[model samples]
Target: MTTLIVLPLLWRTRAPFTSLLCITVAGFVYLATDGPGQPLPYSPLVAIFTVAAQGGLRQRRFAIGLGLPLIAVSVAIRTNTAREYLFAFFLFTMVYVLGVLARTRQAYTEAVELRAAELEKARQAEAERAVERERARIAREMHDILSHAVSLMIVQAEAGPLVVRSDPERAEAAFDAIAGAGRDAMVQLRRMLGVLKDEPSAAGEPSTSRSPQPTLAGLEDLVGEVRRTGLPVTLAVEGRPRPLAPDVQVTVYRVVQEALTNVLRHAGATTVSVRLTWTPDDRLTVSVENDAADVPGPRVRPGPDTGGGRGLVGIRERAAAHGGTAAAGPGPGGRGYRVAVDLPVVVSSPTEVRR
Candidate 1:
């Protein structure tokens, strides 16, 4: 229990290389000069443990080589018979392997921590990409809402001035149409913002600010709006209509909105038809076609901002995201333009009551 025996174990962690050299030299000197009754100490293994924990493969091997010679010297000086040498050799080997195991355990812990850090970094990168994509989707939605609302309001304003002096009744009706379209736009925009704020609920559904999402059920009101703008739009529904998932309904609504907006801007057609068909095989079909108007075939192309060429691309992307299909082009005989979208529906069990 002298200071030399206990003090080396304390320095093993703080200064391992120096501690190893000191313990080896002191143990050798003690065995060379001390009396036979005094025992060789177990303190040298403490230094070996520290070196193996801190050093790499080559350093641990070198520490082991440095340690074995001290063990041999102690055995040669202390042992008097062959049996004593064998017992000393076996004991030294067992202690050496214990230090190597300590080093292996340290290396394993570090490897695990490095892998965990890499996984966290990859997860953060994926989250960033998802946010960018969501921002782009919201931008597209705002563009569609504002462009459609503004066009209807502009048409009403242009007509109100022309009829205000001659017919007070018609003037009032035109102003009313503009006011209605503006109100609807405000409500829809607020509803979209609610979706951005409201997180998913416990039921695993997106709990938005509004209760019901726009669906084919609202097609009549949309047709009415276009008719007010002087375009006679007819609506027809086919097959047994069924309720769809909220997100799918939004996509369907936007597709029809964009298609009709294109009809007002590009096709100079006075008459248009909106059709919806539901199939037993879990698909909903939407078709919009316009009759050739005073303006001949498809008009001279305008930029993407007004003509809605990019909007049709967006429609296709929405449908494809849900494993659906969309087509757009002139109708048979090249008369009017037609846009058709087919979307897959998640069919619920018949036992569930219809909302």
Candidate 2:
């Protein structure tokens, strides 16, 4: 009797069928040994079988198949008098109904648990994606701010000597610009490091210094810095350059900066063109092209420490984070490299912007 009661609780396991069979056999044996003079005690073996069959079998069929035999056996042997037979029938019906209800309840509970687990997994995946996006944004910002500053310093450093011979006063101004550019670079680097600190720590202390923000206004200074490199870079705007969100402006500036840097490092081109176009539809597009060098020289291999090979990779990541695309390779003329990026002018809602 105890075994029959306990079997239903274990019906979720692999041996449910075995448990059902054992409980049924035990009930029949007890019936055979105990005479009818005593009460024909009922066993919940049929309920256990009904519940086990709920694992796969149809409830109506299982109840009829199992119930009829026990009923017929009790009637034939007189182990249960007619009055007791009706009472046992009522009792077993209630037991089977309760068993089915328990099975349904258990199934519902398991389904809820599984759904909760799936939702949790999806939330975690979304969080990881957001973190990756923020890292890319910070990287693009760092490249734009630092590259602009560095380009200016390089141009000023080169001009210092030329101006020194002609006008000492102008040479001193160039040196002052170099110092200012260095300070700006350090400030930008600090801001980037601060953003990166949000990442989970694996070891020591995190840096806390913040950097100044860069916007489209900074492009003028960037252009001036590049011209200092002795490469003639022209900046043209097709549509009115309107103020943009910090991130979008930063992305535009970085795309142009990286393209120009690649021109200086690889193409050895003397003349370069940069065009920024803004439309009423809130779209921003940037194009950078440089004339092929006079004599095609050997390509300069990027060194490990310089992170030189990752420029295109970095640019692509930046464009994608802003819901835009970047294309780079050979230009239509098949002589010079052309890097272009198209970014939507509209800012996504706060909800759309991943934390």
Model 2 lDDT, residue 326, Cα: 86
Provide the TM-score for each candidate, comma-separated: 0.75, 0.68
TM-score of 2: 0.68
Best-performing candidate as measured by TM-score = 1
Go through the candidates in order and give the clash count of each.
Answer: 0, 1
Q: What tens digits encode model 1's per-residue C-alpha lDDT throughout 178-227?
A: 99999999987877877777767679888744656666566677778878
The runs of at least 3 residues in candidate 1 whose Cα sits more than 4 Å from the true structure, single-residue gaps closed, are 1-26, 33-43, 58-73, 80-98, 165-168, 194-211, 239-242, 295-310, 348-355
Give residue 253's lDDT in candidate 2 (0 to 100). 69
